[model samples]
Target: MKSRHDMIERYIGLMSGTSLDGVDAVLLEMDAQGKPQVVEDSFLPFPAGVREQVLQLQAIGHNELDLAARLANTLARIYADVVAQLLGKAALPAAAIRAIGCHGQTIRHAPHAAYTLQIGNHALLAELTGIDVIGDFRSRDVAAGGHGAPLVPAFHQDVFASDTENRVILNIGGISNLTRLHRSLPVIGFDCGPGNMLLDAWCQRHTGKPYDANGDWAASGRLHQSLLQQMMADDYFQLAPPKSTGRDLFDLNWLEQQLAAWPALDAADVQHTLLQLTAHSIAGEVRRHCPQTQSMHVCGGGAHNAALMQALQQQLPDIRICSTAELGLPVHQVEAAAFAWLAWRFCHRLPANLPEVTGAAGLRVLGALYPA
Candidate 1:
């Protein structure tokens, strides 16, 4: 570990996951050996109106092109504001930061259709922040016949790979994804299924809270086993590797349709079942693909949910499950840190996407740069 006195290049990473809650900005410093150290981080939730607008645009609609463009600009302004705040907190000027790796809000991820859309006006961000910006890190992988997601597995391998033991890095954001790091086998990863998206949406619909704090609401309810079985019957779980999914497949409408089959169920019971759905789907994927995984380190907002964590541990009794904090990076900071690492990789022209995980044509240096 470098002392506070060590001078290192700083990079900024901005991420807004599918939960549509907010943007997370992380300022990271990388040493000569390519290890990343977090300098400072910030989280800014979206305004109520902006979050509603984003939710509306998640599907096909009238005048979507115009709305998307406007939303992108709005999101860019928010991102720029976050950049300013991060720089201010770090006591560093914009010039001190080499570049910002911005994972623009993913509006659509349809790799099967050979395209994915992540919208944030990088040009505007660069102009506003007075710093270089790298965005659209997934399009190249999609163009190369890949899922264009779970992209952080490469970063996980770089930072969390262990020679002494097999490991799996699980990121439970709006969507849950896992990366398998074997001591000998090739790294494997993919989207497991819904993470906090369904649970949060349900909580918002029933309790008016943004999410189940520590999953207390979910803990208060009883798990409806029948409902969970029906939910697990979804084909997404049984699909083979090289697969990915997003709000398009697992959104409010989808849940409503599933709930329709089992009428007269309590809302809290439904919330409890949704939580179990997330745990079961994720555990099932790990068992099928990386059964030999010795340890699992979870990250993202879902990691803070004590009930969800307990459910995951119950589902995978043999594997040691814990938050990424044990490994150094905090749960909420891992995704942002990965994007910062991506910016560092882009600066060095290093390949950031792993073909095995994304099913891309080959290793590729992801993202496009917009100079300030």
Candidate 2:
């Protein structure tokens, strides 16, 4: 048998975030030093009808269990397809990969209830892909009285942290979250607020496009300060660290309800204000928690929004801000890669969640494994 120190393992990570945009898959190799090297990756767009069904499930609906289960199976099939594509592109066999880490489609997250659900049939995925699968990464942390989110911060510290300067890794996915890494302080992370989720939903409703490409639509209009203030008043923003949020709190219905107070606002203005809400909320959290942050690195779809980036720059005029790509990981791949790293931690029986970050009972290894 090979000695453990000489062993190398490969993992595949699949992430379908709250953006409801698509699935991101990545293949990575972890060596003895616990460094991950990305081998290959791909993005598979969700089927249009499936995406609609997912969005609908986010709210109260009839037959939701049935709908969620059906969506889980569909997502498994999609994940399997993406895994196959990754294997072919990387020229690796199924047996060569140790396991797959999947962050399933999050339909409802109520960590305060000590329950958060992510649906994707990992057993089915393992069966179809002929590879072991590891999933349900959030529940254990939640069970231990943790928020069970912003889990990626642990991975961020390992891969992106700097020892000389304070840095913040901001992941602007459907919902934005940040990881605070300082040379002297312990790691801290929490959900900042809305990211591309609101912007994309508003863009689709008003312009029929899935998202505000390059944030052009938002840039074409002026910000509505009053409306922005109303949206920012959400209670989630005022909470301290050990927090996480999702579409359950910042969805289209919530936005519409907030807009009820300002009935005459233009659609473009609403989009612009939504953009500002994201920028301001994120910057506010950064200033409040990591005021000494020397720089900020962004990742996820929101980094592609030029106008949003510019707004963020304006909000944090003193701190340097840029994409995670500058640190060797592309904006889109950071989350997926984090899942891959989580799988590595699982296989090694290592603790993945930070007690300081998630308020878990203590540090614990997360995720359950389903063997091939």
Candidate 3:
């Protein structure tokens, strides 16, 4: 086994979000204070065939554990491959990697039914990489009566907290979530609403592109006011804090139902409405809870979409909008990097879940640990 300290205690964080585009691996080196410094980052594209298989599961009616295991094995192969490549990019040997923080593909997340499933075997990851792996991050929190989503915000507090300034670290990933961080309080977090998931899914279906680059496609089109209003009417938007959701609630089905009455609209118009919906839902939540979260620091792929960012800025005109990069973390690397920080807490038997955020019984170590 590699000596944890001898290995630099550098952790790798891997995330494959609902967008199902690729695997993102972030390398974080912790200082003596346990604060993380981003060492390196890389994303490995999911083979088109693999993505197709994953999406196809959305249509299947029957259940098959054997087939799911097959997918899991293949996925772990790519996951470990991604971890290896990211470490290589950092010019570090695998032996020096202390542990990996992996958020596996979330196929279904329904806390209402007391269940959420994320596939990618931690044991397989440990066996493949010969490094201790920390994953299945959401399950422990769920079992403890938390939403089991937005776990990244706990890590965000550790990395982004400021003593003199209050910060709202809004992560516009597949699902939009915000961490309202105050100087002297535990970070508050919850899933805000749709992020890239809807926009990307819509674009892929209509144009074959994986996502709307900079939301330019949406910018070229006009928002259908009625459709936009109806999309915002989802009950999920009105749910209080301590809640989370997945594609199950805002899937293509939900969009189709809302748009069915107006099938006469142009594809571009539909695209425009989807983008507006994401920005609108998130903006409303910020205004409702953290009215004084005037300094908003955004991180994730959605932060790079110029049109969406512009829309958000207009909604909160009095607030400051900036990317996490401006705060020393890259937009693309924040979520994965948060997991890296979470693993650091896990290794020390420290609590990572925020009860104020996840409604857990209390703070607890949030992931299962695997030995190197």
- Whose lDDT is higher: candidate 2's or candidate 3's? 2
Tens digits of per-residue lDDT, candidate 3, 276-366, equal: 8988998898888776675899988899899999999988898899998888988889888888888888888889888889888988897
TM-score for each prediction? 0.97, 0.98, 0.95
| Model 1 C-alpha lDDT per residue in residues 1-372, reported as the tens digit of each score | 776547577899999999888999999999877879997999988976988888888889999999999999999999999889888898999999999999999888889899999999999999999999999999988888888988899889988999898899999989999999998789988999999999999999988999999998898889888889988999998898878899989999999999997788999889989999999999999889886888999999999999999999999999999888898889989999999999999999999998888899998889999999
Winner by TM-score: 2
Residues 226-260, model 2: lDDT tens digits: 88887788899889988999998988889999999
What RMSD value applies to candidate 2?
1.4
Candidate 1 wrong stretches, greater than 4 Å: 1-7
Q: For candidate 2, report its TM-score.
A: 0.98
Better of 1 and 2 by TM-score: 2
Candidate that beats the other on lDDT, 1 or 3, i.e. the better one: 1
Clashing pairs in 1: none
User: Candidate 2: where are CA atoms >4 Å away?
Assistant: 1-6
Clashing pairs in 2: none
lDDT scores in order: 0.91, 0.92, 0.85
